[model samples]
Target: MSESLQTLQTGPSAAAPGDFGWHLGMVLRGYQFLFEEAVEGMPAGIRGYQILSTVLHRDPPNQQALGAHLAIDRTVLTYLLDALVDAGVVERVPAPSDRRARKIVATDNGREILAQYEERVATAESELLSGLKEPEADTLATLIARLAMDVHRSQPGSSPCEAMDHLP
Candidate 1:
């Protein structure tokens, strides 16, 4: 028999398919797939939307900080920002405190698109969690955020985006 097929037949597998890390991975993948579809056709899809949202919600110190916070690499963030800057969705303006550093800010158009996308994405997320009761969903979100924050604190300087970096 083929090695791959043999492994699948004999290898350890999650007992419930909804247990532990495998279950988390499956859920996250589902959400990512749904979110990708949710943000389609809006300039670089989810990545661009995230960048725009970051700029809109927080005044990150500079491109580097934004990249770090988004868990995107500096080079990737630069490339992504190039399209956003060209499309006039965001601008890197010189920071008042530091001439060399530039802060990201969303333009009017970027904000508008982000607002629309936010509504759509929220609906998509709601639907994704539709199986859960409202309180369960809220508790889940809160717990997840708290867990992530704990991880961030424990693993200083690691990109949160790294969670999705290895997925197929």
Candidate 2:
């Protein structure tokens, strides 16, 4: 097995010294739970919701452009779009500029679902950040956004750091 895989298998049950991987794993687990429990029924995960929301406000976003702006892989984005299409929350239309390219647009149902889920996500996040006051929460958000923009500007070929970035 790969060294990384082996380390993952034998690492401390909880995060330990020099265990950034373990901490990231825990964060992913928590995110999955929070998303599934709080936002699953809302038409998409946070990523999907963001895509739909963006498309609603800015329709006819070609897949490549969407992938670039959202920093999602085209392959993974294909599946996410498929799910949304299957759910009747979004539609893919052939791009007017390029027949080979397809654009994503939010359906009416998608808009409603996204709206509902956004509220739920806000509630869940507020609960998670309850320890901080409103001003602190706002400051944290601003700082995180700045950090994400910096990382994105610096990383040319890297997929977005999911934790540091948001759907927008």
Candidate 3:
């Protein structure tokens, strides 16, 4: 077995000084709980925010590309898009180049809502990382971003969160 796998298999008492999996898992769990709460009022919670944010950031090529960028299933993306439309956060405009297809776009209200959600999410993130000093937290965030970029580059179509889909 690989050294890392072995380290995780042994309980803390018998394991190496720190187990990466355990630490990462604990952090993810904490963030998930906090994030769920932070975006609870959103259309589909975190997912709705993701779609809205993506639209605000770019001119989507089409619904399929949007779903691919997010690593969301096409069918699921449709449902999320419907909710976002109902919430007045996003709209499907006819694709300029392909009249047959629709492109997702954010509304002015969507941008405003995203800004509010950003504040809440940032606060939740700060609370989750409160154990770390500011500098330490910044360092951790930088390192994680680098790692995510590497994963994204390694798997051309995989988003950082869904990079695991490309793993063996």
**What lDDT score belongs to each candidate, Candidate 1 first?**
0.85, 0.75, 0.84
8-81, model 2: which lDDT tens digit per residue? 66745844455765655665566566656677765547678768867877663598888887778888889889
Model 1 misplacement above 4 A = 1-18
Each prediction's RMSD to truth: 6.8, 8.6, 4.7
Model 1 TM-score, all chains together:
0.85
- Answer with 1 or 2, whichever has the higher TM-score: 1
**TM-score, ranked from best to worst:** 1, 3, 2
Q: Candidate 2's error at 52, in angstroms?
A: 1.5
User: How well does each candidate superpose onto the true structure, as a TM-score?
Assistant: 0.85, 0.71, 0.80
Best by lDDT: 1
For 13-34, candidate 3 gives per-residue lDDT tens digits of 6755465666776777788789
Q: Write the per-residue lDDT of candidate 1 for residues 1-168, one digit (tens) a residue.
A: 887656656646615323557768888988988899889888877899999988878878888788888888888888899999988899889987798988888999998989999998998899889999999999999999999899888886877467787865
Residue pair clashes in candidate 3: none
* Model 3 bad stretches (over 4 Å): 1-18, 156-168
